[model samples]
Structures are given as C-alpha cells and as structure tokens.
Target: MATDSLPSAFTLFESIQPGPVYRIPSLLYLNSHQVFLAFAEKRTSSSDVDAKILVLRRGKFQDGSVEWDETVELSTAVKSGYRSMNPCPVYERLKQVVYLFFNCVEDGVNECSQVLWGRNAARLCYVTSQDAGLTWGQVTDLTESVIGEQVQHWGTFSVSPGHGIQRACGTLIVPAYAYIIRYRCCLIPPGFFTKPRTFYLYSEDGGERWSVGEPLSRCGTGESEMAEIAVSYGNRVLYCNARAVAGPLSCRRPSRVEAVSLEPGRFEIVHPARQLPESDSGCQGSVLSFSCPASDQFSWLLYTHPVGSGKDRWWRHCRNRTNLAVYLNRRPLEQRHWEGPWVVQSGPSGYSDLAYLDQASTFACLHECGDRQPNERIDFRLFSIDDVLRNIEQRGRGVATSLKHRQ
Candidate 1:
C-alpha cells in the first residue's frame, strides 16, 4: 500500500437516507464530446432482485473539474415486469453512437434460483444515444435474434457491468458470462450443477450485426471486462480480467482470472492471475489499458479491486471488503509482472470501472465504496500516471528493505 493518502472521493450516487439504493456502477467516457456517462441500477433496496430502473448521470469535463447533471431515469431501457441491471456502455466512434447494454431479469427472480433450477429469466438488451446521451433511442432486445436457442441452456447470463471496448479495426467487444447448467439435483436446496465461463458479444460492422463468441475453456470465471492494447509495433490484443467465482470447479486460491485474445472473439490463453487477489465469492472489478506515457508503441494495464487487509487467509470474506487498490501491469502479456495496488480507498470498497482521459493524462475510477459498507455509495477519483508510478516505486523499495533485514 502507498504511504500517501489519496485525494478525497467525490460521491456521485448514494443510498437515499432510508429507502431506495443505487448499485452496479458503469462508466463511459466519450473522447469527442469530452463527456462522461455514469450508469447504475436504481433499486428499492440493496438486494439485486430489487433493481427497478436504469439511471444515468452525465458529467462534462471542463476547467479541470467534472460538472455532473442530475440523475435521469432511462425509462425505455426497461421491459415490463422485469428489472434492469448491469449497465454496460459501448461507443461506436464512426457512428458517434453510444450503446448502453444491460440485462432485464424477470421481476422477483434472483440469480441463485435461476442457476440452481436451470431456468433462464434474463434478456439481453441495449439502447443507443446519438447526441452524447442528450437523448436515447428505444430499447432493442437481442436475446432471440443473437443468442437464440442457446440462451435456453444457460441457467442465467449477463453482459459486462462496466464499459465495453472498441478495437482499432472497428470491432466492438462486450465481455459477458453465463452459468451453464450441468445437471439437476432433486434434493431440497437443489445442488448448483453448473459451470460459469466468460465470453463476449462482438460486432464487426459498427453496431449493425452482432455475434456471440465462444466461452472461455476455463470454468468459474464471471462478470468480466476487456481492454484493447498494442502489444508491439502495429500489433494489438484484447486483455480480459474477470471475477474468480469460488466453487468446486474454481482454482484453489482466490484470485482474478486473466486471458488474452489474439484477434477479436476468441481467448487464446487463459490462466489464474496469482498477482491480483479476489474477494471471497468474487467481486466485479475493472481494467483499462492506455499507451505508456514514455512511448505510444507500448501499453500498460490498470486494474482496480478491494485488497484484503487482514493477515488471515480468509481475510477476503464479505465484511472485510476494504482497501480498494489499483494495480499496474507494464507488461500486459505477463500475468506475474503486475505491480502497485496503490490503495486508493483504505476502507470498504466494491465494484469499480476505469476510464482514461487522453487530453489530461489522467485516469478516472468510478467505484462502490463507503465509510462503513461498500454498498453505501459510488464515488469517483482522478489520478495521474505519475502518481501511480511514484507510489509503486515507493512500495517496491519498502519491500526490498524488509527483505534485507530478514536476510
């Protein structure tokens, strides 16, 4: 952890004193408009099944500060008798269209029941905005057209709860996951005979046509996000980081799962990321890649998640969701080279999404964090690349000094 404290967080969404609560934050930055669109699930309570509406707040960056507008409900983004959740926004640069993708789950139905029973009650949907979120078009349901019969086999599925990516070649990629039913147990509290795997939805001709990619070969990975970065001169690949779901099928240690796609849809390599720790039962984190400050030919990856504080092996249990940290990987292809959990928030924190402002050389993190519990509020923080590098260097020296004393 960094010795220096981070700047105070700017609260964007909070739980209304007693009633309605907000959760599942997704952040999108439009380079051309110089605007940011922050999305969240407006629920009657903190429970996932209570999600009722999809809400958004627009923030315009100017004069070194973000001026956010009042929250607006995307009425068209929902379906009758269903709850909207997991707000994922993707921008089509050529069309100047921003597509907000989310899942509409059947009302009163929770994920556990759906998975255990092998019944899917969620729909894949999205709405678009042409004028930088000033207005949105009608909701488009693609569950039948794209997913088709395949969805029936899925116990339940969802799109990335954060921002999606657009490759340099004009391909749009949305990270997603599904719990495929393996069997059914007739006993009470029926066994969850299912396997969770990460996959993606992609579009080649802007947002005109979409296709589902093959699910990752590895199991027990879910709620993922992707970033397209240059690995070499004129060469780029898609980097993915996902929540490591704990189960009999998962890895022995709790850690984030990572993979890379040589092209657009298929993940060529999958492995457990030992360097990044995942909260027990897993929590959705965010990853963003940006050009190295020293050279545009190379890129670096930034990740944000809650870092366990206690020395006990079981420290990542629910109540201990504290010390939100941002890690950097200079060599994106090498999972072992990750560095610096820069401890941005030293208290309870949860889901996070990252965005880079090229003009400012700054990174913005829209995250779930609070003084007592992580779900109490969603806050934002802006820090520079230099800030991360300096803190990481300090942490490296501290570790080296400790090693010398032990020897």
Candidate 2:
C-alpha cells in the first residue's frame, strides 16, 4: 500500500506563533469505556526548560471515527514552582481508575545540570481520576516515600513519557530511568560522572503502594516504556524498549535497547535491536503488546519510532527525527526477528505513543511531526494490522528485485 493512500491524520495539538508549543505525547485507550485519553506537555517554547503544564484531550471512538473534545490544561496536576513533563498514564482494571504519572521539575533547573552536580531536582508524582479524565484528584508526590535516600546517590530521574501497562497478574508497571553517579571527585567544584539506566516503578496491589525496581545492569539506557508479553505456554514476561544514550567513547552504537524481566527488580538486557533503528543522538519510542490478530493464545509486539539509522551514514541531510515508522514482531523474545517498518509518517517526526484499538483491530499513534521541525505539532494516525502486513510484503519483494539486478 502507498503511504499517501492511507487515511489522513488528525491534528490533536498545534503550536501557535509566539507561545505555548506542544510536545511529548502520551496516549491511552480504555477498552471498557471505548475512549482515548491523549496527554502532552504544554511548553512556552520548544526548549525543555520552557515546559509549563500538562494538557489533555478526551476522544470518543465510534463508527470508525473519533470525536475529540477541546484541549484543557491539567491545572491541578502541578506544583508551586515546578513544570510538569513526561505524562505516563496507566489504568487499574478492578477499580477502573486512571493514574496520570509525570515528573515535576524545578522551574530553572535542567537535566544537564542535575547530571553534572549529582543533585536531583525532578520529583516523581501522579494524579488519579475515577471517571476516565472528566475530573482529576490532587497531585500525589511519590518521590520522598518511594525513592527515599536513594535520590541523593543519583542525578535526575523521570517516568515514561507514554502510557504504562498493567499485567494480567494485576501488576502495574511504569517504565522509568535514572542517571546514577558512578564517580565523584572532591574539588573546588564537585565533579561527578553519571550514566543512565532503565527500571520500573511497580504496584502489585491495586495502586495503593508502589516500589522502585532495580535498574538494568547495562549503562546508557534511558526514557523507556513497558508491555506485558506472554511467552510460550502462557508464561508472562515484561518487555522493555528504551532509548540508547550512546556517547562518543561508548562501545555500543546508538539504537533502541531491549530487555526482559521475569519478575520485578531483575532485568536481563538483550542486545540492541539492529532491525529497529534509532535516530541520531537517540529519541524516545513506544512499545505495545497485543494478541495476534489471528490467534488468541499468543501475543505480538508493535513498536513506533523514527526510521533514521541513528547516524549520519545513511541520510546525510536528515539524520534524526524523520520518517516515523512502526515495526512488527511475532517472536517477542527474539532480537533479530523484527519485520516491516511501515512508514506511518514520511517526514519530520519525534517521540510517539502507540495504543491498540481492539474493537477495530487498529493501532493509534500520537506523535510529533511537522514540515520543518519535528516538535512543531502533535498529530494522531490510525492504521490496521493488515495495512502493515501488506506494506512489509511489498517492500520485501522490492528489495529482492533490486538485489537480483545488482547480481
């Protein structure tokens, strides 16, 4: 199928001239309510320090179309002198409550300063809504109670900028990462070296209490999302896909890092997924697990991100944050079995969040894409599994024909 022939995308949030830009999309779909909640950071400009507040829009899905309501600022989900960022929403099934998790950073403090000085300024917090986002409760600060003294040992930390997942076993998993200080030198100005690693904030009992799981052993991993996948014979495992923050001297190249955890507090890091490429300097992506469209007993994985090769080797002019694509994998545990990067958006694109609409066998992507800059506006697109399969098959055949001519 041709990219232009697909359904047209809807603009959920657009940036105006002299103010209030939108970025960092977080999308969640509630099956019971047949509704979609889209969240994003409303910033004064494109810079991170200019982030002001969180905004939300509720969409009602029916008859193959969505009616999105007006966008509203989450005024109550903020602190006195802090800016809210990284909206991570997870639904609790039994109570049918939605927990909107985000990081509240001090007004002027940026993440680079936090990593250098080994001082943490970001606070882990959330708010709850019983009516699927009609109204929200007061903000609940979880940094002090959950992170505790450990906050001093590291730099900055934050939750997933997208939606979290609730396992079939009733465990709520919120993907997160922290910059841990590895070396400190006592001098005129305190010096510290830190590296990013991924972990989870989980609640086993209906969102009453939460605990921090152990960080992944590998370094240079950050800004992640999680999904619960059922391996062979109905054994559930947690799968994480994170942004790889590779440095000049680092051994690993820039790519999306994958890991699996059988239980909480322990993660087995898999090799970087070569098939699913990352943009240069790394960009956040989303992963979602759903039952195969054909089979009920097994699950498949769908990941959405930019299609750049994570370097200047391939596309010289546009090396990063371009060509938003979605890759499909039938074998969730394997690293090299990914197929079909069905290009959802062919131009400038940035961070994206994916949600499965089971009623129509479609996947929805809320992403940042624009003509010049990737973060200029936020848009949403819907495509079915059949669409992806058809595109992948065509691309494979074209590649084979090209190789044959070269031989």
Candidate 3:
C-alpha cells in the first residue's frame, strides 16, 4: 500500500435546464487519444421534461489539468420523443466506432422499470460515432428483436442491463435483467411484483449484430442487476449479481451481493450476502470488476455503493456512496466470507458508474451530486488501484496484528 493519498481527478457538472436530472448506468469509453463519457440528462419544463445525452471528453487528468471539451446533445425531439435515460456506451476497437445504447420512454413519467406497466414504455436504441464523439450516425433501435415476443402486453416490462464487456474471443457480453410486474390490487398498482431474471447478449461480429443468449440465472422474485468480470484468477470469467429480494409486504428484503463463474452463469452461495451495514432502506449494491494482484494470492477488491438509508417509498432520497470490500481467498469462496465494507467516498456526492481500466491499475468512477438544482452536475474521478489496495492491506494487517497480540 502506498503511504500517499490517492489523487483526485477533474470533475465536471453538465449544464441542463431547471433541474439537472439523469439516470444510472452511464457509459465511459477510452479511445487511444481521448476519453469519452455519455450520460442522459433531463430538463424539466411546463409541458414535459426534455431528455438528451451529454458527452464530455478530456486528454488526461494528471496534475489537475484537462482539455475539457464542450458537451454535445445526442437526442432530438423528432427521434427520441420526450424521455430518454440510462446511456451505455461501448468502444468497438475493430470497427473504429463507439456505440452508445440507451432506453427511450414516452413522456417523463415512465422509468426504465415502468416497462412492467401496460404502457408504450421503454425500448433500447443506440447511436454510433465514427470520429470519437465529434459526430454520430443514425439512431437505430436495438431492443425490438432481442425482446421481440417477450414484451408483447403492456402490463410492465424492462430489460435495462448494466455495463457491457467484449470477451477475449471478440464477443460482446451484455449483462441484463428483465423485470415484469405480475399482480396488483387497487391500493398498490399492478405489476409491482418485480420478477428479475439475469441474461446476456453476444455480438459475434463486432457490434454490428448481437445474439440473445440463455438466461444466466433462474427467474427469481426480486430486483436484480448483473456485472461481468473479464479476467480473474486462472483467467476465468466470473459474473457478479446483486439481488433485492422482496420481503413481507409490510417490509422490504435486505439486498444481497453474490458472484459465480460465467461458464455456468449461475450464482453459487459463496458468502452470506447482506446489504451494507447502514440503513437498509435506501441501499443498492453493485459489483465492480474484481482483481487478484500478482503479489497476493487471495486479495480482491469489490467496488460498490454504501447508501446509508432512505424514507421515501421508492428511496428517492437514496444517495450514492462509494465503497470497497476486501476479501481473502484463504479457503474456497463458498467457504470463505467477505470482510470490511470500507468507505471510499462517502457523502451526498457518491461515486456511481465505476469501471476498472488500465489493467486494474486505475479505476474510474462517475457520479452525480447535489439536489435537482441548476448546480447539479456529474463528476468523474480516477483513483490509483495501488492506493485502494494498500488501504485494504493495511486494514487487514491491523486486524491480524491485533489478533496475534491478543492471543
């Protein structure tokens, strides 16, 4: 572990309208010479809130210096209707194109989750850029075929997946989950029972086309999200999941985080998963890429959010708090457990959209802060993996030394 503190990178807040509103699942891409970030932004108005994509670029962030580029809007009224959110971008090196995927909903009322409601709701569309972020190709619909027959009735349906990665074999593996509302009474809206199932889509020929693969896990009664790790120990592919189980109607279930190998695409109960040790009310968990350092045999870092608590029915006030947990592979994962939900960034401005880059030497985290005020903006920060690892090691050593002294 390095004794010095991790350096903070440059942060930028997009300038939208009355309220700077955005959604989760923003995309970050690195194109040899520059870095590109695409996120959805919504501006409230008298009639409806207009939504568009805000693109930002910079050469690098060392020495607190940056050649910040102007923000660009990717959506138009004629093409995108009035609502758009959850922009995910993937850089296709072979094709020399960057593909930006997002969900388009009608008006401002339907969230990606509202696809469960019988409404002309969310669908996945994408735009391509040949010259970095300077220009974009035609906006094309990508979800129609993948979700064709599954989304027939309006009741409610959503297949908003998280970060996507290209496999070593040049296959694009997109981790997604489908949530459908099943039953509802007068007091509670129907289609509120979220049945989340994990699945993947692959693109054999670059990003030109994709094939829907088998469901990663059985359709469980809960809200679930999936993430994929490209390289693990022994070069194995691993899949991570965070499931929000529905507790009794009077109370909510505690969310749990778990992982499994991609060969089987099933979650094995390796550890006793639990929500972060804060107020379970407004907490959501995400499993960032996992890595095992060359020096250590059993050390891995799991980046996630440690949102403390919330009161609103939907956890509207839930803020994103960056957290990392260190695990020791002393025994098999199914036998060993997790330790320390260490705080990385804790505040109203928590880090979201986390990605591991530069061979796990650097980590990039993007998050939005502030209330829905004009000042609300998205921030991108890069941290040294060494610094994070050192913190975890020091904590581990402290615990070990204490145990030895006591014994």
Number of backbone collisions per candidate? 0, 0, 12
Task: Please list the C-alpha lDDT of all candidates, in the order they appear.
Answer: 0.88, 0.87, 0.50
In candidate 2 the C-alpha lDDT for residue 108 amounts to: 94
Structure candidate 2, residue pairs in collision:
none
Tens-place lDDT digits, model 3, residues 197-283: 555555778987776554434444222334444343445455555444433342443445455654533444333255333223333
Report each candidate's C-alpha RMSD, comma-separated, in the order given.
Answer: 1.9, 2.1, 5.6
TM-score of 1: 0.96
Q: Give candidate 1 misplaced runs (Cα > 4 Å).
A: 1-3, 184-191, 248-252, 315-318
Q: Give me the displacement of residue 26 in model 1, in angstroms.
A: 0.7
Model 1 lDDT, full chain set: 0.88
Q: What tens-digit string does per-residue lDDT give for candidate 1 at 250-359?
A: 43557899998886679999998999877668889999999998899989999988886745365336457777888999999976999977888877788999999988
Give the candidate order by descending lDDT: 1, 2, 3
